[model samples]
Target: MTLAPRLDRQPRSALLTVVMSIGLIYALLPLVWLIISSTKTQESLIGSFGLWFSGPFALFDNIAQVLSYDDGIYARWFLNTFIYVVAGAGGATFLATLAGYGAAKYAFPGKRLVFAIVLGAIAVPGTALAVPTFLMFSELGLTNTMWAIIVPSLISPFGFYLIWVYAAESVPTELLEAARVDGSGELRTFFTISLRLLAPGVVTVALFAIVATWNNYFLPLIMLNDPDLFPLTIGLQQWNLQAVGVGSQPIFNLVITGSLLAIIPIVIAFLLLQRYWQSGLSAGSVKQ
Candidate 1:
């Protein structure tokens, strides 16, 4: 009987392993191509195999050119991306956490209505709102400014919804009540007691916000026309456009190198914050 069970499990395990391997390959294939292509020169990129390296490695040279081109404009784009990601994502996470906690824990007038609105907002695609957002920003004379990007990014309905769901399930009513009974103000209780418990959820929401803001292209593209104010995505697109039009432009190399550089910060962030994700998954599993 044990042998029969083992034999049955073997096929299932093998199938799972195969599926996982396929998925991993699919995910990593593009990154591998990027790395290989980044190492190759412009001629090799066109003439050589897509997946393999060819000719002299020009990784350092390509990186240098990417940074030094156009008076180091790529560096400026990098800085703008950092500002948007940090300020926009961080602000969005904070507002979402506060709003979510209120929606989850407190009884207020029209609370359900407020949550419904948030849900509706979450359902609406951000792309759909870009035109209207641009119009509004233009009206307010905020277009082509950093605030134009940061302000719109601050209002993340999905983050709020995630935190709302997490807060309801992960936080204990009794704990808040105990803190209140101990004469702790609501704000203090929220900041000290509840916030600590919500750390995992907060981290998860922040990661989502950061990734969303970092990858955002269309909104910034529409909002800001100034090349100097452009984020990496839009700036890279501009470079790509220039490359296509001009004679003997190193467009392909710049695109590949810039893309690789753009992804580094996000990868580092996920690696560092991944522990919080694991902890969040395991939270509330064991009773204290």
Candidate 2:
């Protein structure tokens, strides 16, 4: 009886491990394939195994073609994306930080109502609002312009929510009280003291806003018709469509390679700035 006691439990454990491994592979397989496929040529993509490289290695060649093709349009797309992220995400983070701090620290009439609206807004999906946003922008004649993308990006409900919670917990009330006693203005205290402590949360929110703006395809696709104003996501999709279109030149390798290259900057940013996130999350945990 003792010898046969645990056979069923062992099978369940083994099954769970197997299922988790399969799930991980399912999630990571596409990324692995992208890395492999980027090394291939267009013909090799159609004729060769997808998960492995075939034909002469063309990673650098594909990158060169992607950069040099279409009058260096991809470069413009990169620059556009950079500008959008900086202006849009940067503004959103600034607004969210101040609003969240105010919500957490100040007492004002209708404050709870305002937060209620913001929380309700957080539950609303961006895609669902895209149509209304587009129509509103169209009326304002902001369509087909960079502002269409940037304006919407500057209104991040989720960022506001995150910083609200972070500011409440991470910012010390004692520090603010002391600053007030020293006759420091609210703006001075925010910029000098609170902002320093809010570092981890600020970095976290900025990273989120940047990623959202960077990967936003639907918004830009709906708002801007000009190919020159396209971000990398829309630009890549356009290339993808042209590849599949009748009698169009197939540049599958360049498209795939461009995508892989497009993501590297975000990855680099996260890697370099994550240290601040750790410190921010740890802020105001201890008091004298």
Q: Say which candidate scores most in lDDT.
A: 2
Scored against the true structure, residue 95 in model 1 reaches a CA lDDT of 98
lDDT of 1 at 11: 40
The digit string of per-residue lDDT tens for model 1 on 137-250 reads 999999999999999999989888878878887889999999888999999999998898899989988988999999999999899899889999999998888777757476
Cα RMSD of predicted structure 2: 5.1
**Per-residue lDDT value at 146 in model 2:** 96
Worst 10 residues of 1 by lDDT: 1-10
User: Superposing all C-alpha atoms, what RMSD in Å does each candidate have to the true structure?
Assistant: 2.9, 5.1
Q: What are the runs in model 1 whose C-alpha is more than 4 Å off?
A: 1-11, 246-248, 279-288
Backbone clashes, candidate 2: 1
Residue 174 alpha-carbon offset, candidate 1, angstroms: 0.9
TM-score of 2: 0.89
